[model samples]
Target: MTVVEADGSFVEPFVTKNLYINSGETYSVLVKADQNSSRNYWITTNAIKAHHDFVQAPPPISDRVIVLLNTQNLINGYPHWSGNNRSLSLPHTPYLIALKYNVTEAFDQNPPPDTNDIESYDIYDVSENKNAISSNSIYRIGFNTTVDFILQNANTVKPNHSETHTWHMHGQEFWILGYGSGKFDKVHDTKSYNLINPIMRNTVPLYPYGWTALRFRADNPGVWLFHCHIEFHFYMGMGIVFEAGLEKVGTLPTSIMGCGKTKDMIRP
Candidate 1:
């Protein structure tokens, strides 16, 4: 197939047999079905990958760089996925309501660290990870600030291997700068970023024992979610919350109320 567009935007055409279409992702491709017209051909929509060629997106520069460690450990005796050594324990109150109402008590302020603290962690090692903790944390970003995010995939507690995950972000699209295998070397890897025409996407895949880099501008208002798109993985706590420019936002629609503290805002 000759690929032409990604996520609804046209790209410099490229050819490949395997394609990694992450969740919330769309592509337009041209397949030459000239071969074997006598029999039906099977089309693969599963995940693999091919780098894109063009898109109007943020340059490969950012005001801040946040490295997120993707790992798993036993949280309360069950295997759980986590980011930056913390599994997200969301509060009953939707984060948008909590942030808008200044309800400090509604959610924990524990934001996932921007960097991984585990020194010399082996990506292939299947040993038990003991440093993880669960919390109702969320991240606050300065509106319009550009951020470069690097995802480092790591080993888990029970499985003798790491797993690939499809990461999705709400409220904004990001420029996928590049992807790498093994531990990410900030100094060396930064040079490989595609500054010319990196594609814009809301979701991308993190290869097992590999890394994926993305850059986005937090120009949107309100709270957004950044998480593993896999249903089971997200349920296992592989995600984080983001809030930016809330002061600029006006009253949310009344339809958004009636949960947690918002119940009071929606009276009879």
Candidate 2:
């Protein structure tokens, strides 16, 4: 995906690599459990986020939010599925976290502190209703030459007697920024991702009712699909496409990248 500036001009440095955080910047953090589960995930360090919790007084500044993998665990909930036989005492570490910063939370205008010591929530209180504090996994991909893209998943969901839902994206890979419930907070604006890297494929499991966030560049000019890959969920409209770079791709005859077959595009 290509990263463009506010005025439609392309940002070179940002589009060079999947740089998770911009250079010379740091964000304060706090940890909290998902809504019901005592399993604590990092919320915000200084302020309040709708679906996440924090251990420190997060500075009032706004930027892309990240989950602290060091502080997540499964302490208070029963095993999601007994047949699977993963340790009940173990917290199912998350692969990706859904982000809820843009259009949901309000952004702050101050620069953040360089170094901050944040506390974590009680491990014992981690509950099932809460966002699962993910012991996150990180993957690095190189775009082309100058920039590299980093990505991960942070949220998960286990509905009562339901199959685990894996959220995946098509044509573009994104960074698992953060996870939360309710509408996304409209604060943290979209982060610029470097696209001068290799292409990537990704999938993240979501906690039922939990939302995850992704950071990627809109460099690829295609109608990309972001949805639950459960197939059933997708047919039911759990899928939404991110339309980027459509203008440059000019309107080809409906025969190309269209929903209809050749016969449909042409009238008899």
| TM-score for each model | 0.77, 0.32
Model 2 spans > 4 angstroms off: 1-164, 180-201, 250-268
Error of 2 at 190 (Å): 12
Q: Work out how many backbone clashes candidate 1 has.
A: 0
TM-score top scorer: 1
TM-score of 1: 0.77
lDDT of 1 by residue, 1-268 (tens): 8999998899999998888778688989898768977897887554355445334757547888888889887777787888888898778888888888888888887566788754577777864455568878888899999988899998877556889899999998999989988888888888998987788899999999899999999989889989999999998899988888899999878898888877877898
Q: What is the C-alpha lDDT of each candidate?
A: 0.84, 0.34
What RMSD, rounded to one decimal, does every model reach?
Answer: 8.7, 22.6
| lDDT by residue (tens digit), candidate 2, 30-131 | 333337675554423332234223222212222333321111223245222110111112112111111111111111212222211212222123323442
